[model samples]
Target: MVRQERAIRTRRAVVEAAAAVFAERGYTAATIAEILERAGVTKGALYFHFDSKEALARGVINAQISDDYWVPRELKLQEWVDIGMTLAHRIPKEVILLAGIRLSADIQGRSLFGSAWPAWTQLVTDKLVEAKARGEVLPHVTPRETAECFLGAWIGTQFMSEVVSDWTDLNDRISVLYNHVLPAIATPAALIRLDTAPDRGARVVEEVERQQRESPVPTEA
Candidate 1:
């Protein structure tokens, strides 16, 4: 068990190190040696988890979407909003997500390893489908189409924010995105109830942490 846990930690470290390198230097320019130096792991350890740099980039992309920190909400639309806002909040801080964004935007790297957009689009599509089932979305809204459009807007917003404000205004840009897009797709009741505030991501994270702390731990019977 200890060895398995160690391996998991080692793999995670390698991925994160790779992310940092990839975020700083484009995939074409990034070197395995730099990732290893950043990871503080041996070559054999990195190779054991990832066969190549391409594999490492793929791992970084895969790690971009995780719901472990999220708490479920009664409103599916609000959950969707939380996902975007939380990502906006985290992107500037998290190397992995930043790397994913960088790789997805790199023409050469994207051609080689594929972009994370499809996965993100599918994630949003699934959430929108759930929201539609819950009657949170308008009747004319199509989940897949909406997801694709929203993701495109999100990517553009991130890029513009990065260029203009160095991502200092990403949360606000995402809030504005939601404000503009939601009114078109979300039901009036859902739109009214949803919190699209720029500071919502931080608040939601705090709330999730509070809930986790207040809830009793489960034990085997």
Candidate 2:
């Protein structure tokens, strides 16, 4: 059990180090030596988890999205908004996510590891589908189209935020984005109830963590 836990930690460290390098330097420019040094792990350890740089890059790309189990909200749109807000709040602090987004956007890198956009679109579509079913979204809103368009805008917003403020104001920019976009998609009642505060992401993340902590752990009978 201990060995498994240590191996998990080591693999995570290697992935994080690689992500940091990829985020700072484009995928092609980054080197295994640098990742090794950054991770402070032996070459063997890295190779054990990932045989090549491509594999490491793929690992980071796959690891970027938050599969966090959030407590479901009464309003599905709120949960959908939380998805964006939490990402905006967390991305700046997470090099893995930053690297993944950068790598996914890199035109040159696209052939090697495809963009994460489709996966993200699907994720958003699923949530929006739920929201629509609940009548939280407008009748005219097509969940897939809305999700794709919103993702395109969100990607652009991320790029602009990173360039302008190195991501310091990402949450604020995302809040602004939600404010503009949600009004059109969400029902008037839903739109008025939704929270688009810049700090909303942080709060949402905290709520998830708090829920996790408070949730009862199952014990063997």
Best by TM-score: 1
Over 117-168, each residue of candidate 2 has an lDDT whose tens digit, in order, gives 8889998999999998888989898899999999999999999998999899
| Clash count (model 1, backbone only) | 0
Leading candidate by lDDT? 1
Clashing pairs in 2: none
- CA lDDT, every prediction? 0.90, 0.89
Q: Where does candidate 1 stray beyond 4 Å?
A: 212-221
| lDDT digits (tens) for residues 86-203 of candidate 1 | 9898888899999998888888777778889998898889999999999999999989999999999999999999999999999999999999999999988898899999999878
Which residues of candidate 2, in runs, are more than 4 Å off? 212-221
